[model samples]
Target: MKNASAINGYEMFVIQMLFSGAAAGFIYPTFLIRSTEGAYWIPIAVWIAGALLSSWLYSRMLARLEDNKLIVVIRSSLGTIWASILCLPALLFLFGALIVMLRAYSEIITMTMLPTTPISFLNGMLLAPASLALAGMMPIVRAARVFFLLALTCTLALLILGFSDIDWTLGTPLLRTNGDFLLDKHFYAGSFLWMGFTITSLIGSYRMQSARRAWKSYVIALFCALPFIAGYVYLPIMTFGRELSQRLTFPFVSKMDSIYHYWVVFENMTAIFVSVTMLYVLLIMALQLHALGETIKSLMPRAKTGLIYVIIFIVVYSVATYLSSWRAVEQIVFITVGIRLYMMFVFPLLGMAVLAFAQRRGGKGNEI
Candidate 1:
């Protein structure tokens, strides 16, 4: 493990800690979007429920294993080969998620922001930033903190503006006429992104400080997440209602276009919002990419971590870029993230149990 200079002060760590949670939350909107195969909130509602379950497991992991990282906890308690094997789903999901996010964001940028720019060139633009982020995990995390704030601002701006352009009458239809198609698809696929919160549980805490302000960090996490849910799901439901929100490709931006501030100089505010959103999503993707890359590198010290990270970014994003159809991408998300989240729930719970046993065996003198 890199000698982590523990981020000091509970409050500072509290702020930093919550960013992950917030970052996790931001992915939900994208998750809901990609997973939005049927109905309105069914999948999302399931996702939120699963997320809360993950949160419960997270606290268990934190409480029982005071010192070990998630990878170590898994390898030691679950057996290295088995744990590593289990990690495949997460690795694939992480890689796929990052790839898909980049492509989707680039697509969003192309569609909304840089209409004239070719996707190939726009995708290439992500390299430097992604590389720079992967090169230094801490710095990327720090950058994420800033980006999280910016993303939040943009989301709020979206809510304020969404009301302007969106036709409120769209909410009129039955929320979901179904008992069947909605149940089968929306409940199953739509909530894939809410699994983003699992990052906090899976990656383990990097910048550990005194556990004094843990509650504060938890509070911050909840605070960060609620607004994100609001932005991705709540705002859309409010603005476009059940009928139109499911139809819109980029519902957030679509809502943004409805409201206009004639005095505002920018011709397309959706473009600006998307760019800001992309930056935030990029920060998150970089962090997850770095975390997994770092963990694997820690296990294999001889490898150049930077090169590995770059390779990973390229490979995943390339596949994402290749995903030509929206449906294909959505289905992939269901399989990948759904599988990752299943492991997230299982291994973390197992780790917590084993750590608790280990702690009892050691008589609590040392948690590591």
Candidate 2:
């Protein structure tokens, strides 16, 4: 593991921003719109609240452990047997997320940019992530830092340009929908969008300087992403109305398509939006793959990092290829929502318990 000093607060912020930004785009807006209808903002609010709470819980655990990696702390508090057992779900969660994201992005690319190209050809894009993961952590962090400015600029520009079509009245009577919708299974299912702050937990130990900075970075990143997320969800509904927006698969992209730019070089702004978003998604997949490799190394100390990444690449590629159609991929995405919720809530509680156990045992020197 690299020293915490190697990673500064700004880099940490950029990493969180990249992950959260990518997640905020794409299918998340669709899930939020479909689940909440007119009351879509309600779930967005709930998601933000849930994310703050989760980040707080994780920050507390990090502080108590004196900045040790979560996997190490888990093993120390619970014996290797129990720690390995707990890690099983986490491993599954990471891999499941990887598969779902890979399939989702590929499906979108096949529909948008490469309609005539074979799905397999589009899936080859996984090689980018595979190469990044194999290169190790520093390269990924550097890439995030380098691209963060351009990506944020373009995204904000797109959002600003999109405001011309907004109709404030479309989101009226925000909570008029049936209250039961808030408690529905799909409501919490969409929490993954905001709950992406949890990505900090996976990579936090690497370049984390202090728990306070980490927490602040997370909070700031969430706020930074708020406008874009809101624009992604509400802009579509405001432009197309809730009824029509709900029916469309990718309403935000569709919203972009509806905009015509006569003075611009590219006739379809959705193409530009897709291109920018694709860069962010590639970073996300690479980060997930790196997290999977770290998880495996924690369990088997002797595992070769290269071999671990190769195995992950093969598994993800094979599964994504097998689930060839949109319906199959959608099912996988819905199924993993439950898994994501489990990890979001359970892991933090487990961390608190582990911290308490360690404290009772007078294990103050447990810092990794």
lDDT values for all models:
0.57, 0.76
Instruction: List all candidate RMSDs to the true structure.
Output: 4.8, 2.8
Question: Model 1: per-residue lDDT, tens digit, 184-303?
Answer: 443454344445445544444532232223433544555455655555555665666655666776676665666567776776777666666666566666666766685665444468
Give the range of the ten consecutive residues with the poorest summed lDDT in model 2. Answer: 200-209
Model 2 quality (TM-score) = 0.92
In angstroms, give how far residue 127 of model 2 lies from its true place: 1.6
Give the number of the best model, judged by lDDT: 2
User: Tens digits of per-residue lDDT for model 2 on 1-368?
Assistant: 55432566787788878877777777777777777645776677777888888888777767776656777767767877888887787788778777777887777777777789877767778899889977877888888888899999998988888888778898776667666546665566566665554655665363234766777887888887887888888889889997898788778888888887677677878888888987788887888888778777766767888899889988988888888587786676677776677777888788778778878777556553
**TM-scores for every candidate against the unseen true structure:** 0.77, 0.92
Task: Tell me how many clashing residue pairs each candidate has.
Answer: 4, 0
Question: 140 in model 2: Cα distance from truth in Å?
Answer: 1.0
Q: In candidate 1, list every pair of residues with a backbone clash.
A: 164-258, 164-259, 165-258, 165-259
- Best prediction by TM-score: 2
